[model samples]
Target: MITMPSIGDNLARLRRRAGFTQENLAERSTVSVSVIRKLERGDRDSASLPTLRKLATALDVTTVALFHPVPRFAPGNTDDRDDLYVMRRVLQPARALSGGGVVTLADDEDAPSSTDVWQSVREINGMFRDSDYAAGVAALPTAITYARAATSAAPEPHQATAWEQLAQTYQTAAMILIQLRKDDLAYYALGLAIDAAHQAGSDMLVASAVCSENWLLTRQARFNEAERAALATAEAIEPSLTRSPQSDIATWGWLNLGAAAAATRNNRMDVAMDSLRRARAAAHVAVGYRSPHVTHWTTFSPAVVAMREVELAMVTGDAGRALKAARSVPSSARPAITYQRFRLDVAAAHIERRHHDEALDVLLQLRATAAGWLRYQRYAHTLTSRLLRSRARAIPLELRDLADFLDVSD
Candidate 1:
C-alpha cells in the first residue's frame, strides 16, 4: 500500500540518476520546482498521469518505472530449502540428460484413470479449503504426477478433463507456495497451470489460473501490476450478465475483486470502488455460488465483497471504516475462508485503535480454530510482533503464546 520506495522515493532516485537537481528537472520538464520538491519530500502521494509522463520524458525513463518497487521480505530459513526441494524438482526437473537419469512414477498405477485423478484433486482442494496445509502440501506431488500421467493415458474422451485437473493441481501448488512466501516458485507453478489450462481449451480454467496470478502479485505489493492483470483478464472474460452461466459470472466477479484490492493498495479509491460496483452486479446473480473449478473463492458473493471492503479500508489505514464495513460481512452462511480473513481485518482494526487485548483475543481464536492457516500468515506475525513491542515486561500469557506460535521475537 504505497509501500517503501514509494513514488516520492522513486522520483528522488531517478532525478539523481539523471544528474538533475529539483530546479534542473523542473526547468527541463517545464513543471514547477515547488511541485518537484514536494514530490521528492514525500509531501505528494502521487502525480497526475500527465505530470508523470513529463517527468518520465525528462528523466528518459518510462512513466511506469516511477511506480515500480520490488516487494521486500525477511530472509527465509534453511527449513524452507528442505521443505521445498521435492516440489522444486517436480515442477522443474533436472536438465542434464547425462546425469544418472533417476526413475519416476514407479507405482503400479502410474497412469491413474480420469475419475481417480479428479477425485484426488477434489480431496486436495478440500484440504486447501480446510486450511490443512500440511496434508495439502504432502499430497500435492503425487496428485501432480498422476494428473500429468492421466493427460496422455486417460481415455481419449476425457483427455481434456485430465488437462483441466492438471491445471487445477498446479494452481493449488501455486497457492500453497504463495502462502509460504515463495513467490518465485508460485510464479512458475502458475505458468504451468496456465499452459495446462490452455491445453484443456477451457476459458474458465484459464481464468482460474489468471486469478491465482493476481493473488500472488497482490501479496508481493505489485499493486498496479496486479490491478492491470486482473482487470485485463476480467475484460477478456466479461460475461453476458443476463446469459452467462453462474461459473462465468462468478469468475468475472472474482477478478474484479482482485483488481479492487490491488487498486486500493495504490490509493486509487475511485478505481477500487468502481471495480467493487462491477463485481457487486455479478455477485447479486451468483450469490453463495461454489466453484466447479478447483480454484478457491466460493464464487464472488455479497458476503465476500463486504469482507473485501473491510480489507481495503485497512489498506488505507481507515480503521473506522474497516470496523464499519465489518458489520456488513454476513454472520451466517459466510464463506469459511473469507470470514477468517475478515476476522484478521477486524483484529487489524482493533490494533489500529490500540485495542490490543481485543486484537489478541481475535488472533487467539484463529490460532485455536485455524492453526494451520495462522502459522503461515506474515500479517499475524507482524501484528504479534507489534503487540510484543507495546509490552516490554510482564507479557500476558496469551500474548506470549501467540507470539511464540507466530515465531515473533520482541
Candidate 2:
C-alpha cells in the first residue's frame, strides 16, 4: 500500500527547503513560534486550514505542497501542475538563447522573416484570447526564438518589425508570469521588452511596456509607484494622441485605466475616479476609428470601463455599488482573463452579502471553466474556505471535492 508523509514532516522539509528557521517561519507566517515548534516536532496532530494557508502564503508554496512533496521543475510548488509544466517549456528557448547559441526552427530552410515573426506574435495573442494558456505557453518558446533570430538576421529596414515582435513576445511572457505570481521573473521580462521596444524606436510600444510595468507594480502592492508610473506614461503618450487613430487613443485610455486601478488600490478615491473619467473620454474619441496598432489582448472599451468600475467599487468597500457596476459589463466584450476576474469579484460581493449559494455557484462555474487558473488565485481559495467554514455540516460533495483539490485542511 502507498503511504503518505505526516504533515509535520512535510512542513518541516518544505520549510527547510525554503531556507526558513522555525522562528523565521513563525514570524513570516504569523503563527506563534511555540505552535510552529510543536507542529514540527509532531507534538500536534493537525493544524487549522487557515493556519496552513498562512504557512503556504508565507513560504510562497501551495497548500498542497504542505501535504505532499513538490514535483521537480515546478514553479515553486504552485497548485497548477500543468501551468508549471507549461512555464518550464516556454522558458526553454529563452534559456537556450541565454546560453550564447543560435536557436534553429523546425523549418530550417531560412530563418523566420519579419512577417513570420509578426504572424507568430499574432498567434500567441490568439491563444491568450481563446483562454488556451497552456497552448500559448507551449507555443511561446518557438515564437520567441524565431523573433530573436529575425531581429539579428533581418535587413535594417525590417529589423524594427522583428524587434517589435520580440518585445511583444516578451510582454506576453511577462503577463503570463505575473498571473503565475512570479513577479520577479515578470519584472525581468518587462525590462527586456522595454529594451527591445526602445531598440525598435517605437514610442507606442514603449508606452505599452510602461503600462505592463505599472501592472506588475500594482500586483506587488507598490501602489504609489504604480500610480505614478501609469499616469506619467499616459501623459507622455498624450502628445501623439489624434482623434483619427483609435490605437493611440485606446492605448492612452488603457494607461489611464492602469492609473485608476493603482489609485483605487492606494485608497485615493478621487484620483481613481478622475483617471477613470479620462479613460472613458479617450475611449470615446476612438469610437469610430479602426487601427492595427492596438494592444491585441486588452482594449479599453465601455465594457472595460464598467469592469474597472466594479473593481474600483470593490476596492473602496462598496459591495452594492460593485454589484451594480458589474451588471453593466457586456459579456461579449471581455477577454477570458477579464471575464474570470469579473466572476471572482462578483463572487466576493455575493459572499459579503451572505448570498452563499450564489457565491458558490459563481465560484463553481469559474472552477469548471478554468480549474488550473483558479488554483493559483488566493481570492478563489479564500472564498472556498469561507463557504466551507460557514456550512461545514451541510457542504455539498462538489464543494468538498473542490476543497480537497485546493488542499484545504479540515
Segments in model 1 whose C-alpha atoms lie over 4 Å from true places: 1-75, 96-103, 106-111, 331-335
Which structure among the candidates has the greatest lDDT?
1
Model 2 agreement with the true structure over 1-410: per-residue lDDT tens digits = 21222467877888999999988998998877776776678765334434555788888986555645322223236454444443444443355345422222323335566655666676666655544554455455556666776788888888888888889988887776776677776787788888999999987888888888887898888999999988888888784445336677777887888899999898897889899999888766655444463253335577777777887788888889989988877666555676788788888888888888898899888888877677767778888898888784778888888888777645
Q: Report model 2's TM-score to 2 decimal places.
A: 0.73
Looking at model 1, the pairs that clash are none
TM-score of 1: 0.77
The Cα local distance difference test for each model comes to 0.77, 0.71
Residues 152-214 of candidate 1: C-alpha lDDT, one tens digit per residue: 676878878889889998988888777767889889999999999899898887888888898
